[model samples]
Target: MTKAQIRQTYDRIAHWYDLIEAIPEFLGVKILRRELLQRASGKVLEVAAGTGKNLRYYPKTCQITAADMSSAMLEIARSRADGLGLDITFLIMDAEALGLHDQSFDTVVSSLTLCTFPDPVAAILEMARVCRSNGRILLVEHGRSDRERLGRWQDRRAERHAARVGCHWNREPLKIVLKAGLKVIDARRAFFGIFHLIEAMS
Candidate 1:
């Protein structure tokens, strides 16, 4: 789907997005998010911050900015932040071409977003560009499984799955990060190697 189409799709489902993923969030995604975000510090920017799911995981001392391509999704995120009593800046912006200045943030983050981006590498590069030299980029992303059979099953249904939700579930998250030219600090996979927790230096 085109970026505009993806935005519209997300907007249409913004209200239900959290509920739809509740099972997985409860199962393990939430834990991964918390573990990955604890490293964030100083000026932090979360790209594609859908529904602000990561808001409560951040340290209270960090100044946070959350951005997404879909305004409707961002609105929900803003409300979530408000409910959490956390002051956060919310913006409607594309991850591939962020409007923020270069190297303006001490940490950059994104979660479960690479699958849906039209240009995942570009999005990662943008995250790197907005991050300071010594800054860290944290990610919690899901892709193909490590098990051959499960990966094959995902590949077979990848197109259909993407057609429904714009998520290319078969993409490789770690490879995309490397393609973006960031220096990898650490990378770990969980849940049959479908979910990746990656830390990188810009």
Candidate 2:
């Protein structure tokens, strides 16, 4: 999907996205966010920080800058931050092209977002570029399952899923992470190998 398409799709879903995702089938995702996000510290930048779902997982001492392209989505994220009394700076920016200075953050994060980025490679490169030397890059993403049956299910529904949710269900997150040249520190899979949790260094 084009950036405009993604923006519009997210804008339309902003009001109900969280509610929809909170269904029983996805409740485990909240736990995944907490576990994946605990690795973050110091100055942090989060790309495609949707609805601030990960806001509560940050350490109190960490400074956070959350960026998302959709204005409507950012509004909910801002509200979530405010409600949590978390001092977070929210930016309306694209992940593929960030406006921030180089090596500005100690850690960079992107969660459940890589698949939606129009240029996942470019976005990963941008994440690596703004991270300080040896800084951590943490990502909690979902992708094609290693299990054949589930993989086939994802393959069949990938395009339709993208059309409805702005997410590419079949893209492997590690491929783009490596393609961007970030050094992997730790990597694992869970939820039947569909969810990828990664910790890397820039």
Candidate 3:
């Protein structure tokens, strides 16, 4: 999908996105979120922070700035941050071409977003660009399953799935991260290799 189309898709689903994701969150995504976010420190920036789902998982000491292309999604995120009583900076921005200064954030984060980005590599590169040289880039993303049967299933339906939500679920998260030229410190996969937890440095 085009970037505008993707934004419109998220804007239209912003209200029900969380509701639809609740079951998966309960099963294991929530734990993964917590695990990935716990490592964040100092000034943090969360890209494509849909509905602020990760807001509560961040360390209270870290100042957070959440950015998303969909204004409607960001509105819901703001409410979540407010409910959590956290002072967070929110912005309507493009992940592939961030407006923030380079090396400004101590930790950069993104979750379940690589699949939806129009240019996943460019977006990952932007994360590295804005992140401090000494800081970490943490990602928790879903992708093609390692299980051949399931991976084939995902491959067959990937286009149809993306039509519904702009998520290319079969894309390889780790490869895209590597293509962005960041030095990967660690990488792990779960849920039949569909979920990737990655740590990297610029």
Rank by lDDT, descending?
Answer: 1, 3, 2
Q: How far is candidate 1 from the true structure (C-alpha RMSD, Å)?
A: 0.7
TM-scores vs. true structure, each candidate: 0.98, 0.96, 0.97
Q: What is the per-residue lDDT of model 3 for residues 113-186, given as tens digits with 9 covering 90 to 100?
A: 99989899999999999999989999998999989999999999999999887889999999998898989998
For residues 40-69, could you state the per-residue lDDT of candidate 1 as single tens digits?
A: 999999999999999999988999999998
Give the C-alpha miss distance for residue 180 in model 3, angstroms: 1.0
Residues 108-167, candidate 2, lDDT per residue (tens digit)? 999888889988989999999999998999999889999999999999999999888778
Worst 10-residue stretch by lDDT in candidate 1?
A: 21-30
State each model's CA lDDT, in order: 0.94, 0.89, 0.93
| Model 2 ranges off by over 4 Å | 24-27
Q: On a 0 to 100 scale, what is the lDDT of residue 126 in model 3?
A: 96
- Checking candidate 3 for backbone clashes, the offending pairs are none
> Candidate 1 has what TM-score?
0.98
Deviation from native of the Cα of residue 42 in model 1, angstroms:
0.3
